[model samples]
Target: MEEGKEDLETLGEQLYNRIYPSHKEIAGKLTGMLLELPGSVLIQMLQDESVLTGALEKALKALQLEQEPRLTNKNEDEVSVSSDSVGEQLFDLVDVYNTGYSQKITGMLLEQHKDAVLHLLSDPKLLEEQVNLALKTLKEQSVEETDVSDSSDTDDTERLGERLFSLVEQLDVLHANDITGMLLEMDPADLQQMLGDGAMLEAAVRKAQAALKTWN
Candidate 1:
């Protein structure tokens, strides 16, 4: 996994060097954004040059947006209350779901419905509908480029480990391998239960992270 991250960082550097030579310093930041993409998406990006270029461009643009203010003072003042409320809800959407692609998918949904974020947040059913729509859109966007359906080759344990690893990575826990190792060491039934329960998995991850922090 660490090796994979290194390869992504290397690719990110190459991407920035090729297209944004003048902004070389931001390459690392762009690379971090690229890492936020699901592992499958990253692999697809590597196999397809067009996909790679497009993803890199999006990362670059995202970085640029962060460095510049998109709204004027008047606009900020007008939306301050709603933005604050909506922003919290958006964050809850991201943090509540342990799905590996929540961050990327949420960003895509926001981009597609910039003006409707507050409106969507107003109703629970509407918010869920939009989120599902975003998830479907993402799956459709990558369905042709990536085939995630096949896993007949790996045993159930291997598949379980892969799923757990992906979820742990999304947690952004320090020493993720340590947490994964702890989870993997559980009784087979217990491990399977945790894997099926996102809330339990998240709680375990947080507990592990806290313990590791204290010990270190």
Candidate 2:
């Protein structure tokens, strides 16, 4: 009986080393599972190396599958938290000079060039360049859309103004009123141009947002 027990322990050690040479805890668990089999089954496994290895491989695969979602979710959560922290740091840097435009600019950079924003977080100069590039793009878009024509009536213009106000609010609610007031101060024709054309209105709001600090 003692000899039989020693043989079982020896077989368990060999199985553990063969299956998980570098992971003692995992190997021990697998070895325990293997040892739980009936004497006849254990004897067959002990007789055929392929049978023991095959059973271990199947158990390991099932363990991996069971753990996949949990591992994936943990990694995803870590990445999300890391990304938000990086984004906030970048936003504060951009906000120093740009003020209210920081959120919009940072959001644009993340959307258009996410890899750069995340990977270059340590390089403030490069991040500033990215912010400048995003601002330049917004300016160019605004310039392109500024050529819109307007022929709407007073009521149509009022409705358009309300819609434009709402759109600008979506950019940053805290400064929406101030930005809308700034837009209101534009020349009658320019204001009409923005209100009448959706693209023009969006571009105008973005332009106004970028230039918001200058007027302050």
Candidate 3:
């Protein structure tokens, strides 16, 4: 049992390292865009939590996030569960599909890392092997072959904002912090001031809302 546990942890670490990099890099871009308002404007926008939540929901949906496949613990007939999917299952704690829950957890993460709760919105991977491994777990748990899209390009960070959003959704909070560190490339203060200024904030928000129209 101890050896089996070690193997699971080892596999989990390998998969986490592979996907976490892509997850963090992309998460910065999507989160940065949303939090792009001025502190004052953010103070104002913060008044409407639904808008914030909706923005988050919008970003994830754009990423083409599908419902996470349900996991089965026991074998069904000839089917057997695989240990590989432990990676995807590990993130079950972060239920981004639940808009309210996503918002709440994000808020909690941001507060602990005020950098996120206060200034990190404007923000802003393979992703392939890991995703395939995750899908493989589902296929193993059931007898039927899982019909997942085999295209890694489908969510490879170059497409629509949604494509990136889908990738970011896979991240847990620790990865969020790591991504923010890299995003220091862009000045949060500058972005914040740009949004806080009445005119700039208004303009950016308008542009963002307009972009959402094409999200469908």
Instruction: Give residue 36's lDDT in candidate 3 (0 to 100).
Output: 35
Instruction: Judge candidate 3 at residue 156 and give its lDDT.
Output: 23
Best by lDDT: 2
- C-alpha root-mean-square deviation, each candidate: 16.6, 23.7, 22.5
Taking all chains together, the TM-score of candidate 1 against the true structure is 0.32
Whole-model lDDT per candidate: 0.56, 0.57, 0.34
Residue 151, model 1, lDDT = 36
Model 2, 1-216: lDDT tens digits are: 699799888777766667676556688766775675445666677678877766666555434433433213456645443334444555555553332355556556544344455444545457656767776765564455455634333344356457656877876676565456456545556776666677887777677566543321
Weakest lDDT window of 10 consecutive positions for candidate 2: 63-72
Which whole-number lDDT from 0 to 100 does residue 5 have in model 2? Answer: 93
lDDT, residue 132, candidate 2? 74
Structural similarity to truth (TM-score) of each candidate: 0.32, 0.32, 0.22
